[model samples]
Target chain A: MTTMDHLAEQTKLERLLQVDEGSLGFVAEQEVQATRAFRQQLSEFYYQRHQDAFHRLAGLSKLLPISASAKLAMNLLGPVLAAGIACELPKDRAAKLAGRLPTDFLAKLSLYLEPSRAGAIIAAVDEDHIVEVARHLIAQQEFITLASFVTVISESTLRRIIQQVGNDGLSLLKVGFYVEEKTALNNVVTLLSEQQRRALFLAADEHSLWPAVLSLLPYLNDTLQGEMSNLAAEGEEQARDKLVRAVAQQGDWYPLLLSWTRMSQENLESSIRLPALHEEALLRECMAQLEKHNLQQALPNFTELLTEEQQALLA
Target chain B: MSSPIETLRQEGLPEQALAYLTALPEEQQQTLAQQVLSTMQKKDERVEKALSRALDVVPAPLRRTVRKMLFS
Candidate 1:
């Protein structure tokens, strides 16, 4: 590796070490193995280019947090840590940590640790601290229990948390929020709760909201379907024409079309008609695209919406 | 008698296959099984031709073993 690469790796390792004890323990174990693999690769490269390797390592030591002596110490001790201490320390500490942690933190932390009990402790930490730790753990991809964290934290609270974390924080928050929102939306739809469905619909304007809506489609009730259909019709002519255009540009209109079809089927006369005065070509193009994508499975109630001719066209 | 692979495939096992593949170590076992199954299907005509050609040189007992190994 070049000096810059070595420096970068060391910085990452330092950052990993600086994390909370629970996170540090997890990362140290992962890094010890990764470093061994990296060292072997570096050694092979060094053998082929001795001068290059020496220069890189020399420069890298200068740039890295560790002094040359420390690097040497790590080179010697890292294996012992990774193999013996890393494995052994966490097993006991993790249990102690879990017993001390709160229920919410324990839940989130469980997603990252190997033995479920250990994870429970890491997750059980204080909520604010857990959020910070979770942010760090997520950056390292160490914590796998993100879905659990979503249940305890509301979407609005998650959004505020992301705002505080800044842009990079927002990106991670978005991923976690998307997963959580989708699960919550699906849960609401399965329960067919009117209030929950309306809440999800209001939240739908955000890009992060689509996954939740997509997930809920299969379980959507007639009331929810009709609400979405009305939104689509109203949205098409609203001042926020840009939003409608964006949805249209997404190419695969299966979800919207399927929802609309279901709503129309449920309340055939009351539902919005395909405006006869509108462009027939646009509607035809969408129908053709749906057929091309073979998305008929999403529109199982198409027979109720279309006439024999249109039904045949779909077939 | 159903083999493990056959039983798995018959049980609408794609979901299970995906879950197994996700959880498995990045070793050759999972991928190799998939590759072998796909190749067996795609090269069925060539396999039949090769088997017909082999019957002339090999005894029926040896042929059965080869057939079972390749097809299974």
Candidate 2:
């Protein structure tokens, strides 16, 4: 599994166990899907152990008036129990009760609600309410919660939230890092305007988020990856060195070389000429990674950019 | 030999998840399983404590009904 996958799974486990971040670092070497499966079971077990309580609280929605149920959820059940009961309630009824509650309460409840179990209710809630809750989550820097909803919320709702979340490239990158579904992430990238997309590159630079930027590159479709790479190529020479150095240090050359294969010749040359690329050790590591990934076919032009001395190292 | 996989299996961990845990080295499996066991216990205890505190504010007549509905 990729580093981002490990990070995403670790984040989910932290929430499931209510432990501090990095507490589950021991599982970092496990397969990401296996870790995800393990988390799913633990989450289900937690809810299952309390199913009777959740179901009883869900029963209140039927027994009490909608207004009273909403009040009871806020004042009596509190967010955690309210979220558990929300999962047990019928989708329409849950949406109705949610509508009657405050956005702040909904935002707090969102932290406890399992997106998988509450997907239907999330879809049923008003777009405006979801947007408002998203705003609250953004203010709280709850990107993990926000990212979990990416799978369930409609494309249009996500678009609106992205617009509201504009210019904060670090926020977008952080949320995107935790997003598990590549297609969903692609949609998010597609929704971004050219200006918004440019801001992301700048944000990565400003925050020194190159590792995340590199991790995200391979997941985007070819056209967008090439576009983003060409944009990075347009940056000052110092920025180019930073990008190349990050890839060399991380030892993930496939994404960078793949981007090289797609770049306009002018941009590719600009990228490969960075002094960082000329270092013999970095070049050797890059060639090894390229061969490991079997990407030599894509980089004939890239090879031509290197001087004979560097070319000899590859030989 | 006693193993983490066996301990987790006894706790009724789902088979699919247990398969993943079983793949780890014995030492790591032991550590991860212990963490899982402790997390479950901690979450259960925390919820029980929070519920008890939440119930303290309920009116006397309704508290009995709420307790029966949930804990019973």
Candidate 3:
């Protein structure tokens, strides 16, 4: 058989291995051996029609376990497959190729090539496709790893793509549930515009929002703080304290104190905490300044530096 | 003769006197033994206060173990 014919035969055997069930253990061992042979064949197949070779390789990937298939596809195709896909691969063929590959394999492949190819994949991937793929991966409890891969895409473009997907995009976020989603969303929020960030904050459940806001606090700028303060204004006292604590922890204690000062005297006394001595003397200095200034005039811009424990003490 | 504890305590030994104490000679170690005693005493007292405060905040189920470790 010619080299091309031999490779085609090997690809046929791999496809059979995927569904064959005589003995899983024997098939798994044979598949590994076949994979090594396929790698050698792939090296020679490099000069042939790239699309034909990729179609065969995608077939081979399906025969292996998802993890093994993903690794093999990455090793064999890597940048080359991505480049080929980026160039005028017909849309039907591109979709077919994407459909055949495992979600993890597709995600990894997206990372290998030029940024433009990655962008193309992100743009080409419809919201349903993303949600479907994300849901499948989440069902397998691998969303954390998947989120790490998604973060590899350039942040601005990622934000745009996700925004285009809208509430449907939230399905991907929801797949991982609150804590996991909060970690990932914290990353996504940092990459988003102020408006986009606010939208996400407003969309999240109340319990989820507190932790998400706390995680984002250290990284938030003045604009985000203003948005957060507005959001907190509608929440209950405990929720407001959570926001204040986050602001204080982020080194915006002056603004936090100012916000508290503007509350009715009873509320202010009930909610805000003073700094203890051992917990950074700077906190005490801010407290003294707050005391010195008229409650209405000098409070807004002053920031404090209290540790959480100290703040708890004062509270 | 100044008792070592008295001397160290007078010098604000626990916070500001760590450096000076470490510089003393081996033979002088016995002379400053009481300073070590006073330091331990103060540490024990502070630890007790911290434990009591922690107990007030921590839920009841966790307080017993936390108190044992704190006192010990």
Candidate 4:
């Protein structure tokens, strides 16, 4: 590599290593100085909860009542970490243990297991049990748990589970937020039909889900943006205001404008085709707002795009 | 012909074009982006300098220009 290119690569690697080390040190510091409330959260992960789960499971290893061999194994281990001890089990044995456990218990345990290992166990689970566990997780709004398990699921099963929970707006959005897989966001968006997507805003405003809606909006493709804009344009006053305010607050116009650029020609023609926009009085008011916001410079050619009658309103 | 921006609207959101311009790293945004603003005039150094002057004169937010340029 060229000396300059190598140096750039070296610097980038150094920056990445620094970030990793800094975060590790920060976590260590936090642990050392963790406060009372943090201790409460940490209490939830007591090694004993896991040890209890393992002890309870080990005591039931035989098909019949607690067997002598199983009892001895549980007695000898003294204290096994509950989280991933199951991974050391043969696949058949792990699957059998998972099959016998209550699904909610399995779901809770799944959250603490390594994702790849969890995925392996989940693959052995029956769809009926999987569905029940997923339903429970969704109801509990366990997005982190949900996200963890998605990494291991087959796509078709994932789609099935997603479709089942698709309409629970806020919970679905939370899972969308927590997903670790990079394409998981867009994949979720793609699963929604256009009508289902458009309906989110009406629900957003009514349910005060607008902030989440806004956050997720930019992640969706352009057509959805236009669809949303058109829906907003047709919506109530506060809805339109919310749209304007979001567009106003954006640091970059690219996401919204890019959506505009990809909008159907029919939709583009229609944004200005509003009879209201053409009304001189409304035009004047909007122009005044635009000017008040110091946007007059951006529309240098705006007057030319207007009818002479509309242009007169600028005066 | 309508302005390139208007034509772009007809073509549908210039998601790909903006992604290319911004070099956005997100897989979904970049993967789906396509050049929707193909009719844009090639950069003219003269126009660039003139607009640069105009920008200095009015000092408007580029966002306003982008807003009007795309949606007006």
Candidate 5:
């Protein structure tokens, strides 16, 4: 699995257990599906153990008027229990209650809400409310909660949220790294304007987020991957050097090289021209990866771009 | 006395979850196992505690009614 896959699984596990990130890093090598399955089991176990109480709260919501139920949840049950009760309530009713609750409270509740279990409830909520809660979560740095909900929201709602998120590429990068659905992330990328797309590369440079940027490249379609790689090459030489060094440090040139195949010839040449790429050790390692993955054919354009000395080293 | 790994197995943690934990250094395993157990054990405790706090906020006469609404 890629580093992002491991991080994604680790993030999900951490969120499931309400633990800090890195607390579960030991499990980074476990199969992603195993982490997912284990999280599911834990969720099911907790829900089963507390179903009666949560069901009771759901029952009470049905017994009371909608506004009163919302008050009871906010004033009494708190976000965690309220979220549990909301999961058990009818999706429409939960949506109505969500409307009555404050966006801040809803944002708090979202941290505990299981997207898979409450997908319909989340979908039933108004787009405006979802946007409001998303803003609140973003302000609070609740990217994990935001990322978890990404899979459940309508694409249109997501587009609106991304629009509101504007040019904060770093926030999107952090959330994207933890996103479980790469295709959803890819779709989100498709929605970006050229400026927004460029901001992502700039953010990667400014924030040393090349690993995240590199990990994300493999998920984009050929056109977007090429476009993104071209954009990445437009960064300063120092930034490009940082990216190449990051790849070398990661010891995983697969994502970088694979993206090179899709890049415009000029952009690929620009990327390969980085002084960092000429490092003997790094070039040899890149060649080894190319041979290991049987992808030399993927880099025909790249071969023409290499210096004579670099080509000799790679050969 | 069972090992921390065994204790986790007995605590209803799934095999897949423990499999990763089992690979850690013994000291790390003990630490992580304790952490996992604490998180798992918090479910009931947190619910009961939250319910108690909720009940404490209700008017005396309404507390019983709310309790009935919740448990009934």
Candidate 6:
């Protein structure tokens, strides 16, 4: 908006007009930055708008009597949206209203609400209602939605809910792959039974959810982070791309590198056995990425994974 | 399997271009990233040409750069 800002941008544009690959790269970079910034601003604008809408809905929920609200909700809003509206109401009032609602309605509704938004109601309502909701959500295989409450809801509540839901690893696997929140995903994984983690890796590979799971790597405990080498070392292309690319992008490769190093010599040997791992161009590119990121601390792990010829490329 | 942003994310810049947008909160950043990625997937080129023409007051090279940056 300022003259100086305009002039500076104008100068950059002139320089970017050179039309060579480097100039194209610069223009592309600047364009990407501008686009991202615009999108981010739009995202904030819309989020605030939605929050305002929800606040208004909460106010309306307070005005309507329970029977009236339920009828209007059932006929007009549908159960999940009605429950979403109810979630924003005062906890004690929401609890009373929840008690009167059909169990199936409440049960199905949990699948759609953010656990954080529903936290107060989950805590205020009787245990039976909460348990039934969790049961239905888990039974329906809405593991990601169910996992939303993992960090927000009380441990006692989570324990009771999962206990009734059964000990199968499917919930853990589904939650691990599908949950995007960094801390939340890390928590769920760290809490997993060992068997559950294995089941998770297998499910991730089977379903190609490994990319989502890879996003959680940086946030996990160091020991648990080391465990991810096996996930990365999976032979399939989807897993391989997610693995190599994630390591390339992260600031700290120590956890991942160390995981590879800790692999039994045989495991380490077999890691390069994957056809994709053998490609000189990709391996060099991965090495190039590590160098670009300037993570020299990861050298030892890199050294361990590559052949002597490959190690020389880092120089 | 490859997308421009993913390529940019992997090798071009560790700090995502989108990550710099508007300097919003983390939650909004996630939503923005998803929205931008979805929009980018649709690949609208006419918008780029329009933007380029709007900037035609600048030199030809600059005009081309604007169009290429936006659509290519």
Top candidate on DockQ is 5
Sorted into a CAPRI-style docking class, model 4 comes out as incorrect
**Candidate 4 local lDDT, A99-180, one digit each (tens):** 6656666566555555554467668767777777788788777665676576677676677777778656566655654554
TM-score-wise, the better of 1 and 3 is 1
C-alpha lDDT (0 to 100) for residue A243 of candidate 6:
54
Report the error of model 5 at residue A145, Å.
Answer: 0.9
Better of 2 and 4 by DockQ: 2
Q: Per-residue alpha-carbon lDDT of model 3 for A177-224, expressed as tens digits?
A: 222223444545445554544444454434343333433343345454
Please identify which of the two predictions, 1 or 2, would achieve the higher TM-score against the true structure: 2
Docking class of 2: acceptable
TM-score list, all predictions: 0.34, 0.89, 0.32, 0.48, 0.91, 0.54
* Model 6 residue A307 CA deviation in Å: 4.0
Q: Write the number of the candidate with greater TM-score, choosing between 2 and 5.
A: 5
Candidate 5 chain A lowest-lDDT run of ten: A1-10
Calculate DockQ per candidate and list them.
Answer: 0.01, 0.45, 0.01, 0.01, 0.48, 0.03
Question: Per-residue lDDT for A82 in model 6?
Answer: 59
lDDT of 1 by residue, A61-175 (tens): 2332333323321333221111111122333343333344444443333432322222343333345655564565455454223433544554444544444334342233233
Q: Which lDDT value does model 2 have at A267?
A: 85
| Candidate 3: stretches off by over 4 Å | A1-96, A102-117, A137-212, A215-224, A242-315, B1-72
Model 1 spans > 4 angstroms off = A1-177, A180-185, A188-193, A206-212, A215-244, A264-277, A293-315, B1-72
Model 3, position A266: C-alpha lDDT score:
41
Clashing pairs in 2: none
Sorted on lDDT, highest at the top, how do the candidates line up? 5, 2, 6, 4, 3, 1
lDDT of 5 at A162: 85
Residue A152, candidate 3: Cα error in Å is: 7.8
Q: Would you list the clashing residue pairs of candidate 1?
A: A98-A121, A102-A124, A105-A123, A105-A124, A106-A123, A106-A124, A109-A123, A111-A145
lDDT of 6 at A164: 60
